[model samples]
Target: MGFNPKDAIESVKDIATNAVERSADIVESAGYIIKGDVSDGVVGIVSSSMDIATHSVEKIKEIATGRDEDVDEIGG
Candidate 1:
């Protein structure tokens, strides 16, 4: 058996996706508690979470493929 980069990348992607979803759920709950509505929270959470997840996957792919030049560019 040998280490697989593809599997590692996929695992990271899954982690990131799950984190985004969990964060969204937390935001929705908090919004309902504070504003008595989940619409605003849902809208914002969906938009921002998708962007975050997409960017995370893109960065992970770039890093994995050796396409990422400036590591500092991450999270900036």
Candidate 2:
């Protein structure tokens, strides 16, 4: 078979374009595609912070309503 130079160049261009399209599809499907495992870290930190804040609020309430002593001063 005889090879045509123009056809070869067009084939190469098609391949490059196809590769680029496939790559774009993969990237778009994967979402933002940032540099780190940001999900695990952000979720863990937010959840742990919420837990700590809840516990602290409970502690403050308990202190504001002391069992042994009258909390007259602490009451609003």
Candidate 3:
């Protein structure tokens, strides 16, 4: 099939998610925080991917759950 942006996004999202989860596991095993502030630490682990899929998911949940009024940025 031709290139698919959705598939690309999903793959990056999975990668970021794995990084976050793996980092969390490491933190839990060591009984200490990963690095920096908790929120930044998690994002830092995923930042290398240069994809916003995870953040978009978070923003959507924030809006849907009423945790925030809207996404930090509109749709890509």
Candidate 4:
């Protein structure tokens, strides 16, 4: 029987994908597009690093407490 190159390539791809997903530090891997008018306007984008450990916990508390007013104070 002849050797199949296609199967070998697929196996390698699967291994690489698995390795990437197994890492703990990877939170999300997605792209987002911001569509808006920036003509003659100043646009600012803010972001927080993944190292903020308490951020997730605080958000959970805000949700559970059901405080819309405090939501703005948290990070909104």
Best by lDDT: 1
TM-score of 4: 0.28
**18-41, model 3: which lDDT tens digit per residue?**
667666555553442343366654
**How does each model score on lDDT?**
0.65, 0.49, 0.51, 0.37
Q: Which TM-score value belongs to model 2?
A: 0.41
* Model 2 weakest 10-residue run by lDDT: 61-70
The lowest-lDDT stretch of 10 consecutive residues in candidate 4 is: 40-49
Ranking by lDDT: 1, 3, 2, 4
Runs off by more than 4 Å, candidate 1? 1-29, 68-76
> In lDDT terms, how accurate is model 3?
0.51
Better of 2 and 3 by TM-score: 2
Model 4, stretches more than 4 Å misplaced? Answer: 25-76
Error of 1 at 76 (Å): 28
| Candidate 1 lDDT by residue in tens digits, 1-76 | 2345776676677667777766767676567647866676666667667766766766666555455445556557
State the weakest 10-residue window (summed lDDT) of model 3.
Answer: 27-36
**Of the pair 2 and 4, which is ahead by lDDT?**
2
Q: Indicate which candidate wins on TM-score.
A: 1
Give one clash count per candidate, in the order shown: 0, 0, 0, 0
Note the residue pairs that clash in candidate 2: none
